[model samples]
Target: MENKLKFSQKHPLLFGFALILTAMVLIIGAMAVFNFFFFKAHRNSFFGTKVGVVHINGLIADSLRITNWIDELAKDNAIKGVIVRINSPGGVVGPSQEIYAALQALARKKKVVASMGSVAASGGYYIACAAHKIVANPGTLTASIGVKAKLTNMQGLMQKLGIAEQTVTSGKLKNAGTIFRPLTPEEKKYFQSLVNDMHDQFVQDVARGRHMDIEKVRALADGRAMTGRQAKEAGLVDELGGFNKSLDVLRLLTGIKGEISLVQGPPEKSSLLEKFLGKLTFKEQILGPRWVFTYE
Candidate 1:
């Protein structure tokens, strides 16, 4: 008994240290569990005030997901406003126009601010017009207000490689943009007409959103890109500033007082192999060789 008492007395500090460590571990574990459940449910609300932030990065191939996010934010009472951060050269005409339309709908309910990043040109800028205000850095590349259909003729390449492709289609226009052969003059005119019609639609949307004269917007919609500074001068952008500036504008427009919490959409998850290969690839993976009506 005396020997045991002596050992206990001598190691009292160690015993206390171990007890504290055990308590800390239990507390940390509890916190982890609580956070996992509670925060996941209340992810959209932070502290008290909440502002939804949607990031439009990379090539905009589709708008369904983003439009859904905007719709959710618009309906959420906690979400006061939305900030759309865009960094894209542009992508398919349909997707871009769809996103722009969704943003316009969202803006009708809540104040929407667009924050332009390094390369918000073409479809990127097209979508930005739907916002209540646009903020961009002075040096940011933007205002590629045009549409293009990229068609690649690989017939010579296939010939060199001793390859040939045969196709059966319902109509001549069905194979109009095929890469197997060069476009005939008639095909070229048909495609050009399609591009021109889409371009006119783009200009109309921009003019409607920016509240500018349609003719004015048309004058600047000649497939020419411009820097943010130039865009601001041309009245394409409302303000010349970065992300923070955009937030400030949104705060004022939304009448948000005190601290604010920004809730952004969850980033798309990618596999480990995809992440690894993406880093090594020189060019971005295209959906396919389909004719892309893009602003790039």
Candidate 2:
């Protein structure tokens, strides 16, 4: 009986130590996870103001996903302003301009700044021009002031490849750029007119946003690319600087500097452990990111 009693007493003590060790491990794990979170949040803010970072990193689309972020930022009083980091060539004509308009409307209420990454030209520039201020890094490539439509007539190839195409149309322009045959003169004229109209709207929007003359903007809208410095000279960008520099400008404009939150693209929804312990790695994720970005 005495031996059994001693064992029982020792068992509880051992159990207590084991429990304490387990708790320590858990606490350490949680601290590691959340420590980085605080660091990142604090690091992102400037002058005690939260600066939201929105990333436009792919082909712009018609989905509200992008516009919704902007709207959210506009409503959040915690976010003094935004810094849109753009890295894209361009995408569908309509979606690109739609996003630009949304940002312009947001700017009326709060400071909105743009930060051009490796490539913020074409439709990317379309959106950038809408911001209250624009910033580009030393090597940023921007300014593709143009619209392009590619129509493929695969009639010959389809026939050669044993594929066929047929069409019925209510209007003459309904089957305008049909791939089965070459574009007729009327069809060409119709497409050119559509493109020209869209181009005019683009030019006007850029001119109004950049505070530049319509004539000068029209002159530069010839479908060409320019470096960050060159774009500044042509009035395509407001300042030649990087991301933090852009934030400084936003701070100056908004007159608030503390913790800056961002209205950015959705994060890639995978955890670090999920990648490391699992089969995929960061490289695979990056390689696949473009597919997600393009929705293709």
Candidate 3:
């Protein structure tokens, strides 16, 4: 008891400092936990005025998540406008079209602008058409308005390995894209017709969105990519500028003169273990089933 008393008397200030430090660490940890659970609901309330920013990065795949997010933002009255930041080379046909449709629906209700980064080609540009305005860097790769279908034949490799496979199907076209055999001339024609139809659909959407003649869009929709500056000249893009410039455009369109709050969609949730495994198997997941029509 005497020794304890002597130590406390000699180090009272140090003891108080340690106690305060420990309390601060605990407080910070508690706040982190609270924010993780309740931040979405509280964020808008914390910020007086804000524009919701939705990022459509990497390959444009499934649209359910993105569509749901846009719907949620549409219902939120606090979000004055929306900015869709796209950085992609494009992906599957169905998902890209779905995303474009969703964005078009959102545009009817609120002002939505598209900002391109790096490579936003093919279906990336397709979705951008749904926005009220599109902003891109001068050198940004913006337009590759077309579709592509690729099927790899593994018959040669299988024969080299002395392996053979057989399949049974109800219809001949059911196995149209099978890797074991090459496509017949008739099958090739069928696939070409399908691609041409999708191309026409893309052209119609672009013409409608940009208020351009269908013939003008059709002439340029020959699976050719161009710089953002070229796209602007062709009436495919609204402005040639970077992300910050896109925010400025949004500010002007919304008429918000003061400070603007930016709200972004929630980050994708994945476990550390899942992320590690995903890295190992990303290619297979991204390019599932070799025969797919893409806007890449």
lDDT (0 to 1) per candidate = 0.86, 0.77, 0.85
Question: Candidates 1 and 3: which is better by TM-score?
Answer: 3
* Residue 78 alpha-carbon offset, candidate 3, angstroms: 0.4
lDDT of 1 at 192: 100
Better of 1 and 2 by lDDT: 1
Please give the range of 10 consecutive residues that has the lowest summed lDDT in model 3. 40-49
What TM-score does each of the candidates earn? Answer: 0.79, 0.76, 0.81
Q: Write candidate 3's Cα lDDT for 140-223 as tens digits.
A: 998899999888889999889988868798988777877777889988988899899998899999999889999999999998
lDDT comparing candidate 1 with the true structure: 0.86
Best candidate per TM-score, number? 3
- RMSD in Å for model 1: 7.0
RMSD of 3: 6.6
Q: Model 2, 255: alpha-carbon shift in Å?
A: 2.1
TM-score of 2: 0.76
Which rank order by lDDT, best down to worst? 1, 3, 2
